[model samples]
Target: MDLIQRLDSRDADFASQLSRLLAFEAEQDESIDRAAADILADVRRRGNAALIEYTNRFDRMTAASIDDLEIPRADWHAALAALPTAQRNALEAAAERVRIYHERQRSETWTYTEADGTMLGQQITPLDRVGLYVPGGKAAYPSSVLMNAIPAKVAGVAELIMVTPTPDGTRNPIVLAAAAIAGVDRVFAVGGAQAVGALAYGTETLAAVDKIVGPGNAYVAAAKRRVFGTVGIDMIAGPSEILIICDGKTPADWIAMDLFSQAEHDELAQSILLCPDAGFLEDVRAAIERLLPTMPRADILRVSLANRGALILVRDLQEACDIANHIAPEHLEISTEAPEVWAARIRHAGAIFMGRFSSEALGDYCAGPNHVLPTSRTARFSSPLGVYDFQKRSSLIQVSQAGAQTLGRIAAELAYGEGLQAHAASAEFRLDKP
Candidate 1:
């Protein structure tokens, strides 16, 4: 069986074939949706009692009350203290870098006054509270905790609540240490659709948050979709993706491992390579076959590479850049002599790794950039999760008496054109008499 699909851009059906490859339908599973709907409704109605029941059943915990499920600040500090020096230092260093990067992204309120004494501008304010959902148990991600929480903290969110499942009542100290380092205000041992529900709708124990951010499983994603109007949520992400535009000069082994890094994420994750050198493509393929066996997650890597991965032969670097704009992959790597030269051609991509040395893995953890990126071609319109995701903007307008006379006439004319009689009258009322 072929390990990865090979395509040539010169083929007549290349466009359609590439579309077919990129197409991924996130069809809602009936069973998962029904389960999430039932759980959300039950939690909304029963509040804390429902949280306790679901936590016990889903996470294998024996918690009898909400208080029992809450991990206090002291516990977070203890987890940080308990971590080995190396791990703790890494977590703190990563958190500080993330914080500093997001601090530059923080938007400030601004206003401007005109000669007529009219004021207009934007007022940027932090959300009152935010909820971050982290995958727990064997998939515990301390990096995820740092990536999601530090940006919200830097945006000046007043309170940040985190929820992660602790199956069998076993907690992950590294995650807690990250929470402590990121300044998460509260931690709860709950997960799945129930936890999303509890955060969307105020429960007896957990107050409802203004927005929810972070990644989760299918059920959690569905719950966030259903409760979007009730509370704002980060984008519903798809499988991880990486597209490398190599000039065929980088070592084949290096490019091969770069593809595997994203493929190892899951069987559905995608990794594609585009280059002009047919010989280099073969070299990378050989490297993949040679090195794949040594990976710990070789099974997953093989499935992913065979299922969604590809190696395409383009005419040149320009053709590669044009095709990349169409795919708009979640992570793009330009591995060439002058990466910046090709990078400037890329208009669409969630994140771009400038050169061969800038691995996507670095951006995922400690590159001082948010790793929570738009996926599944959403990069065409969306962006990476950052401080802006945790902040709200309000348009400020204070019209002076003289300014109102001038603006009212224009507003009334548009309102009348739209057949909104009340709107027209309201604007006309502020106009000065002739």
Candidate 2:
């Protein structure tokens, strides 16, 4: 599974080639869209009754009552005690790092008063309620619990509700323990589009949330898109992706392993390398060939590399930087002499790894930054979930007698230009002269 093309040779159609390379993300999963829409519509129209029916049908869990939706406190404690001491400690440590990082991101409300008696400021407030979805069963992610809930906690969101899919309507001990560590206020055993629906539109047991976050399958993403207006969503995340930029100094095995990290996620996952040296690219390819056979997800990795992965040879480091900025991968690893020098040029990316030592796995678990990020080139326009995601900002303005007179004239003029007579009249009335 290898792709090699000289940068100069593709110059004539480079734009279209780049466009095509980045365009795979535009291919929507209509099946997921249709399925999620049906579930959302049903839940919106019928409320808990529809939610229960769909959960039973899809999740195969008979949640007869709203009480069945939430995991009990006793269960949570039992799960925490059940984990091995080392794993529990790791979770605790990860939680601490996550909380500390987000604490710095916390915002405060402020007000400013001018000499002219005009007051202007910004008010920062946390959402009253939020919903976090943690994938369960084989896809259970304890790290996601820390990434999603800690930010809301730092932002001071009052009620942080967590929902995870359970094949048998049972919660995972690790997930429960992680949620507890992360300070998730509530736990529910509901997943997929239906869980998202329950959060967007309140069910009897699960209260409606101001925002929904965490990663999910294609169906889950589609559900978030559908319920966007009903409740807030972090982003419509796509398949995971990673790009490694090296200058031939790094070990081929290390580079190959990093590519495999994201490749094992899914067949659609992309792992690309942008390097100026063709010889190094061949070494990385040889490493992949030798190593791919030993990995457990070889089938998935092979398909991912063959279809989504590529190793493009550029003319120089500048060309590599240009291509990386255009791709804007979710995880970009710059393995170079001065990674920081190239890092400053990167204007867009979800999360950037600075050196060879900073692997994608580091960012996934213990790194200070959030692992939940925009995928499939969405990094160009979106950002990772952070303290800001859980907080809302309000513009503050106050007008004194003189300040109103000073500003109302311009306001009236703009309103009049838009043919909003009532708007103009309202501003004029505030500054009306006797």
Candidate 3:
């Protein structure tokens, strides 16, 4: 809590600790694959029978028939009527924003012709259907509902099937309300790997989906990993994380609380602070020490911080930015004087919050961008779920005889070099006609 201890180098083992902490990427037991394979096989083999059994076993509720799996139209209306006007209005406003942002991400089919009359372009098509999994425990994120569904809607997907688990076999009114608001085509009372299996393989009740997108617990994540080849998945996301770069301008209390917001997600969640000023570092550390005792999830934050979180004292803001690129956190907050400058320098992150005023929570709910982000350094390559995830692209190419001959020689040679006689012959035969 004191300045001296806050600035002390006692815990200088950040590198070794980070190596161990990030190793959680492989924490899921190998048995998860086996279990998922069994569930997938059952669903593929038994269809509705497997779904009902898994629902009873995993969700603790029995679905007597396929009809029992679908949420009634009456329930959707009731869930809407149950919400307070203010919350309903809030969801509407958020949905509008989400729609506007994603509409821009939408793609259009295009074609172009060359001088030789060769036509080549791209054909963009929305998936016929998609499956979105919404987490039913702890909290109901209507924002996630908007984030996942709006993109599919904008991408022109015909059917948007959604699955969520209910412990009491009773759906959350708010979640149902959000589903209706997002215009979801179907709602199923299934959760866990079973729900994923149902979506991936298609039971008599649920149709197979082209892609599955959403967030879930360890079991769900493991199932997604196992069923990857069977169906497309958004990403194998890990625990939430937030890394902030600050200077003396921002208050220590604010920084401490911001970090804790992400840390409270779970013990493995990471909250890091990278700053140049040694004095400001100590102040923020003091704030963390002072505030930790009062937080309800203090124990969780403590473990999260001790494990993957840190108050790293970099030499300068440039160094802070460099280190951030190396880690590629899920969320990056720049609280320095010129946050925009720092944010522009950021090459990788699932989401970026610039300036002291723009809190990370803003993006979580009200902000238009999807909150389903890449985690565990996956931001280095992947992006958050969006309209693109709901859409597919195919290259379009056409060739006149002249154009075919012009390009075929190179193609044939490349194929021959790779010792693919069939491939070389296929191209050569077209050219040989002339």
Candidate 4:
């Protein structure tokens, strides 16, 4: 089977073909939207009762009340203690790295005094509460728990509540351990759109949060989109993506496996390689065929590769970088002699893995960078999840009498130009008689 599509930069239709390949419209699923709307409304109307009913119906649990679903602080600590020594150490180490990295991103309040004794600056403050939704059941992601919760904690969020669905009364200890390590204030065994609603609208038992973060299924995504205005949410993520620009110096097998790392995420996920060396592209193709069968998720990897993966023969490294900026992929790896040299040319990418040895997987786990990144060309305007996402800024202004007189005329003129008589008068009233 020809597992990957091959393209050339010289082709007349290359730009259009690449655009078609990159196009992914998350058109609203009417059914999912209707279901989410109903659930959100129900949660808003019924609060705790609705949460309990949905929890039992969807998660296959028999909890009578919201309290029954809550996992206490002691259990979180116990889950952390119960982990194997190696797992515990790795989780702790990853948490520490994530914390240290985000600490540098913390914004501080600053002010400057004008010559007229006017004060203007900005003040930074963390969100009072936040909600993190972790996908539960077989898709347990302890790494996500660390990624979402640690930043909120680092930003000094007063309360961080997490909710995950435990189908059939099953719980994932690793996820719990991550929550514990990340200093989550509370945990509940609830998920799906209903959980999103509960977080946004607040159940009788659960306090409404200022923002909700983390990834989930389609239903959850739709729910987040629906509740965005009522509460803040992280980006509506699309499929995982990885774009590699190889100068053809790296080992073929290494490049092949790097492509597979993102392809295995799901069938819709995209993995593309841009190389100037046609021979090296062929070598990587052979390596992919050799190594793919050995992957545990070979079926998924195969479909993903066959459907969305590509090997494009670019004219040179500069052309590859140009194409990469156009795609603005979620994860970009530069496998070259001086990765930094090419990386500086990249204008848009969620995260850049510099050098041949730096794998995208490191950023996913313990590389000290947030793995939750903008997807689907959103890197053009969006950024990775960090402390800034959990923090808010307020503009500060203290106008002295003399400063107000000087500023009022400018404000009045702008308001008058817009035909806002009330605004013009309000500004004019603050002006001193000349």
Locate the minimum summed-lDDT window of 10 residues in model 2. 1-10
lDDT for each residue of candidate 4 in 1-434, tens digit (9 for 90 to 100): 67898999999999988887787887888998999999999999999899889999998899988889998888889999999999999999999999999999999999999999999999999999999999999987999999999999999999999999999989999999999999999999999989999999998789999999999999999999999999999989999999999999999999999999999999999999999999999999999999999999999999998888999999999999999999999999999988889999999999999998899999999999999999999999999999999999999999998898888889989999999999989878888876
The runs of at least 3 residues in candidate 3 whose Cα sits more than 4 Å from the true structure, single-residue gaps closed, are 1-25, 31-33, 415-425, 428-434
* Candidate 4 segments exceeding 4 Å error: none
Residues 82-130, candidate 1, lDDT per residue (tens digit)? 9999988888888888888989999999999998999999999999999
Candidate 1: C-alpha RMSD to true structure equals 1.1
TM-score of 1: 0.98
lDDT of 4 at 232: 96
Q: After superposition, how far is residue 1 of candidate 3 from its true place, in Å?
A: 12
Instruction: Give per-residue CA lDDT, model 3, range 1-434, as digits (tens).
Output: 22112222235775565465456555667687678777777888998888888887777786788788788867877898889999999988888888998899999999999999999999999999899999885468778788899999999999999898877586788888989989899998888888888899897767899889888877788888878987899888778999898876898999989988999899778888888788888888788889999999878888887776777777778878887887898999999887888888999899999899888988888789888898888899989888888888999988988888988899999999999999989888888553
> Candidates' TM-scores?
0.98, 0.94, 0.92, 0.98
- The residue pairs found clashing in candidate 1 are none
Q: Per-residue lDDT for 301 in model 4?
A: 95
Better TM-score candidate (2, 4):
4
- Which candidate, 2 or 3, would have the higher lDDT against the true structure? 2
Residue 118's C-alpha lDDT in candidate 3? 97
In order, candidate lDDTs are 0.94, 0.85, 0.84, 0.94
